[model samples]
Target: MCELLGMSANVPTDICFSFTGLIQRGGNTGPHKDGWGITFYEGKGFRTFKDPQPSCDSKIAELVQNYPIKSRAVVSHIRQANRGQVNLENTHPFTRELWGRYWTFAHNGQLTDYQKLNTGHFRPVGETDSELSFCWLLQKLEQRFPEPPQDMEAMFAYVAECCDELRELGVYNMLLSDGEYVMTYCTNHLYWITRKAPFGKATLLDEDVTINFQEETTPNDVVSVVATQPLTGNETWHRMKPGEYNLFHFGERVGGNVDELADVAFAEAKPKSQAPTEPL
Candidate 1:
């Protein structure tokens, strides 16, 4: 399976530290060595860097480590080939235009029987099930809304339904962003950590590097990071359960979904800490 990394923050922030740990997993720390790609969102503009080589040894990954390109939202992936060949076109973090906004998506799990899914306007340039699923998602959303929906809660609820349907095939853990918000869905393992004003020093789990986030951030800053696994051993990351989904905007969790929330006993099954931050 591939691995995913995403960030959403109230202020422009760089993901160098977390990325450092994640890149190691592409070869050194784990087995996701096929390719790697990352997309950073800065207002209406975005920048992406990718390589169809092991990120741990790729010079492009080294540049990403040293260069700081601050952004409010970011989507990154390191792949271990499953359905797609190890080529630049088959890389994750596939991008598409929807509702006049650039939407980026990355998946960490494989889907069986995904060829049955249909797409109208959205099409995949690669042979990966991940990209096929992404295209289907956007195509369905367009069919339902035509344009962006006015009722965001309803819109996301619909998104959750789509994800639930996708889960029928196989694991579907993914991260998606529309420049304004990030939506994360979990089918297996996924974790997140939010760093705020009272930030402290944390060490990477895969690397020996340590950094004091308090020194780099302002008092009002709030940044949230989501990864397929916890990137830092020192930080207490919240793990998402299977069949769960969360929406984040400006570093705050704004929405969550439970496919079977009607059951009172099951409603208390997972953590109920973060509240929705905005309408959308």
Candidate 2:
């Protein structure tokens, strides 16, 4: 399995504090090391950095740790590859163009026998199952809606339906963003923490570092962080159930519910083999 990290904020905010702890898990604190990648969205433009090396040791990851690039939405991943070779193309947090926007996605679970799905609009550049799933998702989205929906409720429902199909294959926790907002789904484990008026110190669970956000953030700032597991030891994170999905915009939760997308039949559809042979 892999780990996912995502962010959505009312104000432009850097992910350094939370990312430092997450990178440590790539090799230092956990064994998810295969490759790691991150994306920072600044308006319509995006800046991304990736490395096949472990995040704990990758100089690129170190640079990300120091860079204060700000964004309203972001998606990142630490890969424990299930399908595909350990190469740049195999990294998670893959990107594609959709509705004239750069849509990014990252997966934290394996999908067995998922290659059966047909991707109509998007195609995979890499051989990873994660990328395959992403391509298929976008393809279906395009087919369902020839253009971006004027109704967000319908769009969110379609996205949830795609996630449900993937969830049937296996553990399918994922994060997706279109540079403005974030959509997250949980098939097993995922938690989220939101920071608002009452800023405080946050201690990393993987790294021995703590940050006092109050010193740097404004009273009106609101930032939300989503991760496979809780990163901070002090924050009160909301835990998502097995079949759950959440939509966040400007750091506030728009709509979410486990019951909205829950389907017990899909859980039973999980492939018998969820574990991989080795990382990548």
TM-score, candidate 1, is 0.91
Q: All predictions: root-mean-square deviation over Cα?
A: 6.6, 8.3
Local accuracy of candidate 1 as per-residue lDDT tens digits, 174-266: 999976788889999787777786777776777777777877999899888888887766566777888888888889878887422232221
Return the clash pairs for model 1, or none. Answer: 254-277
What would the C-alpha RMSD of candidate 2 be, to one decimal place? 8.3
User: Which stretches in model 1 have alpha-carbon errors above 4 Å?
Assistant: 258-280
Q: Please give each candidate's TM-score.
A: 0.91, 0.91
Superposed model 2: Cα runs more than 4 Å off: 258-280
Provide the overall lDDT of each model, using Cα atoms, as 2-decimal numbers: 0.85, 0.83
